[model samples]
Target: MPTDATAASTEEAATRVVAFFETLAPADVAALGRLYAVDARFKDPFNEVQGVPAIERIFGHMFEALDQPRFVVTGRVVQGPQCFLTWEFLFAFRNFDKGVTQTVRGASHLVFDDQGLVTLHRDYWDAAEELYEKLPLVGGLMRWLKKRANS
Candidate 1:
């Protein structure tokens, strides 16, 4: 059982995380230190990094590769120092999809430190389905593979 204070802290943490991602930008990379611990570790399908600088680099690459990328947190579950968030990441490939928004549905598992800064962040998503399948050449191959697997 969690006390009222604990529940409030968890809610606040979840809200803060969602707000941070909602407006995340290349310039906001520096703010990672505020939301994450100095030794925070972040892992996703495309990146595995430790520390704020490395995490910032991964987000920086997002801006460089995509246009108008944004994250919308659809759901959040928090218990104690851990939180899980279901989200849709919207973006457009700069060279490929151009202005068309592509949505990647994913979830993030986060562990926070005593100070309420995230200590570990892991993102879960299907790379082939959510990302590679959106590409012109790879999309066909991925679809074929998925169809074959389903049969």
Candidate 2:
């Protein structure tokens, strides 16, 4: 059971994280230290890394590869020192369909430290359905594979 103070802290931490992600930009990557612990761990379908520097590199690559990439937090649940956030990642491929925005629905599980800094961040999303299937040459193949798998 969590006390009122613990619940409030959790909610506050989650709120800050949501705000950070929703307004994230290339310049904001430098400030990740304020939200994540020095040795925080971050993992997604395509990346598994620890430490703030490694996490920063991942976000840096995201900005370099996409145009207008942003996260819209749709829902959140906080319990004690952990929180879960559902979001949609919106962006346009810099080299591909630059005129159209693509959305990737995903969720992130975050565990906060005593100081409200994120200690563990794990993202859940289907890359094939949300990302690869939206690409150019790979999109067709991925769609075909999905059809075959479902048949």
Candidate 3:
């Protein structure tokens, strides 16, 4: 059972994390130390890493690879020292669809330490439906595969 203070701490941590992601920029990658523990773990469909430095590198790569990549947190649920957040990632592909913006819907599960620093951050999203399906040649192949599978 969580006490009032525990709940409050979790809420505060969740709020800070959501704000950090929504306004994240290339410069903000260095500031991850403020919100994440020294040995925090982060995992998504394509990458999995531990420690602040590794996480920083992942986010740094994101900035280098995409154009105007940003997250819009749509909803949040905080419980004890954990939070679940639903979000949409918006970005323009530097190499693919030039000026067109793409949106990927996903969710993240965050676990915070007693001090309100994130200890674990795991993202959930379908690579085929949300990402690969948005590509040019790959998109057509994936759609055909989906249709074939259903039929």
Using all chains and alpha carbons, the TM-scores for the candidates as numbered come to: 0.95, 0.97, 0.98
For each predicted model, how many residue pairs clash, with residues at least 3 apart or on different chains?
A: 0, 0, 0
Per-residue CA lDDT of model 3 for 27-120, tens digit only, reads 9999999999999999999999999999999999999999999999999998888899999999999997898999999999999999999999
lDDT of 2: 0.95
- The total number of steric clashes, by the backbone 3 Å criterion, in model 2 comes to 0
lDDT winner, 1 or 3: 3
Which candidate do you rate higher for TM-score, 2 or 3? 3
Clashing pairs in 2: none
List, residue by residue over 3-105, the lDDT tens digit for candidate 1: 6777678678778989999999888988888899999999999889899999999998888888999999999998878899999999988888689999999
Off by over 4 Å in 3: none
Question: How would the candidate models be sorted by TM-score, starting from the highest?
Answer: 3, 2, 1
Quality of model 1 by C-alpha lDDT: 0.91
- Among these predictions, the greatest lDDT belongs to 3
lDDT of 2 at 81: 90
For candidate 1, the TM-score is 0.95
Per-residue lDDT over 18-50 for candidate 2, one digit per residue giving the tens place of the 0 to 100 score: 999999989999999999999999999999999
Tell me model 3's lDDT, rounded to 2 decimals. Answer: 0.96
